[model samples]
Target: MGKKETIRKKSPPPTNQPVKDVYPTPPPLPVKAPNNGRKNGSTTTGNNCASTTTKDLWDDLFDGGYRADVTIKTDNGDIIYAHANVLGMASPVLRGMLKRAKGCGEKKPISIHGVHQDAVRVFIRFLYSSCYENEEMKEFVVPLLVLSHAYNVPRLKRVVEVELEHGLLNTENVVDIFQLSLLCNAPRLTLISHRMILKNFKAVVATKGWSSMRNSHPGLEKELLESVIEEENNQKEKIRKSKEQKIYLELFEAMEALVHICRDGCRTIGPHDKDFTQNQAPCKYRACKGLELLVRHFAGCKLRVPGGCIHCKRMWRLLELHSRLCADSKVCRVPLCRNFKEKIRKQSKKDEIKWKLLVKKILRTKRIRGSVSFLVSSNSISS
Candidate 1:
């Protein structure tokens, strides 16, 4: 009876009761993540964590919103940018320079704003840590030279000058380096370099003479010699036309005086002169002796027999003797004869004008003889 009463009391559940679906809600539609791809307040948490993880990294990289360390990566390699602080530097200017340097990558990997990689690296290291010294400076010498010229780095240029001074003193590299010094407009460097170059005058004259001749045009050569002469002449000239004319006259007089002095001192002495002793004073009285000595001492000039006239009796005597001794010998064949003959031929050619005139006279005589022979043969045929 109690169970039946409980059943009667349990009426139908309320028709408007909420139904519980088996499928769960779709996670609030994922909140459609923000365009920044971050959850709200997530970055704040991350920022805090990152700051804690790497303290002072940003501070070290940037000072008061200005970056001091510039990172540059190129195809060749990585380069760090730095500069010297002579005085207070402007942040904007520094930033501009950095930007310009970075923009240089458009043309090539190793160039920054037309500055070469070697130069840029040297400049960067110099600016950043002042690390160039001794051996390191030597490694950077060539690049620094280019950089110094490009950027007008006076101090760096001086360093290059010092290196060149040391290098030019070497006998092996003197001539080429002297030319380079002159081309670069280093006057002091040229003086040292010239000394080295002049040490090998004969070698330079024999091997490099053509190039030197080409470099000095007729006008320039004349002007140079004239200037030397003018320097020797200290006499004042009458002012007939202008100061320029007087200067010219003075220069001419100086040049004449110099020539006279040179002729008296150098040209008068013979090879067998009493004062001319190779051991005592080899170059004392010879015109070309000084040049020869200079060339041999520094330029490693080969010892060659002195050239002489082929038509001279001495030369003919030597040839006759050689021919008599070696004519029938197979060992002294075409090559050996040709070598000796060539020496004679070159000596003959030294007086090319005289040889040519002699040859022409012989040809004319031969033509006259040929005509006379023809006439005699005609008369004989007729008889």
Candidate 2:
């Protein structure tokens, strides 16, 4: 009747309990990376005193600071100022001026004479900056150079000379530059000018500067002509030596090839073929340079032919060339030529006579050597 119709009072529908709500976690915000271009060693602040350890400190320190100690008065009445330590470091003359001047405590301004105000300013700036302004300032280089020599500034003088030599070097101005170089005692520049004048001697002589120098500088023109003559002689000597060397190399190659053919011979070109006695076969190896002409001349060369074959003549010439090229003849490979050398030394024979004697001796030696080889072969065959 209710199987316990007492539905237990239905348990109040199990007291409807509230369920907790769930939410998804938001994706982590994308993390930003720092820029790579930030200088790692650099640190800075708005206040100048807070910065430290910069990459090139002297530039910023010498640029425009609150620590300048003295003023410079130039010949043109322009005034500039700089620190005493910088001036002292730049020139011994400046150091001495500071040391000797009295009645002042680092406030005295030094007066510079014989130099343009613009040049003096550039000089002082170079002392601090190690280099001056733009190309517009090139006009001041000569005046700066003069100032550098007067003040014993070697580094600045060298820089000025390089600028003049490279940047200002032209036919129109080279003579002036050369004169300035000579006056400044610049040896490298003087030598360079001398060579330049020699190279364009005609054009240089036609210039107004050369006309002025001719009236003033005497030994220089003579020196230039002598240098030109010496150069011509040197070139002639070089050409002669080069020709001699080329002929010598050709002779050596020909001798080596001839010896090879005389001995065992080659597969392509050997003495067994009658081609050795023919003079008209163009070579396939060394272009059309008469390389095959000597083979016919060497096959049956005779020592008693009253003169000699082309091969014997070349061999004789080779010996003579060896005597000339060799620095020391005491230990020469051409022992017979060494005796020939002694004979010539003793009797002082003419070159033509000595050459004929050399040819004869070479032919005689070939005959003797051939006979000895033939006799040896015959004896061996009989045994």
Instruction: Give model 2's TM-score versus the native structure.
Output: 0.54
Pairs of residues clashing in candidate 1: 104-113, 229-255
Displacement of residue 64 (Cα, Å) in model 2 is 5.9
Q: What's the CA error at residue 327 for candidate 2, in Å? A: 19
Full-model lDDT, candidate 1:
0.41
lDDT of prediction 2: 0.59
Among residues 3 or more apart in sequence or in different chains, the pairs in candidate 2 whose N, CA or C atoms overlap within 3 Å are 2-5
Measured against the true structure, the TM-scores of the candidates, in listed sequence, are 0.29, 0.54
Candidate 1 residues lying further than 4 Å off, grouped into runs, are: 1-78, 83-120, 128-131, 167-176, 202-383
| Per-residue lDDT over 154-270 for candidate 1, one digit per residue giving the tens place of the 0 to 100 score | 555565777667662454445444554555666887687555444554454354532564476455335434644553453333343346544433332332222222233333332
**What stretches of model 2 exceed 4 Å from their correct place?**
1-71, 99-115, 134-138, 161-173, 182-185, 206-209, 264-269, 273-289, 294-348, 351-383
RMSD of each: 31.8, 15.7
By how many angstroms RMSD does model 1 differ from the true structure? Answer: 31.8
How far does residue 101 in candidate 1 sit from its true spot (Å)?
5.3
For candidate 2, lDDT tens digit of each residue in 189-222?
A: 7778777876777888788887777788867666
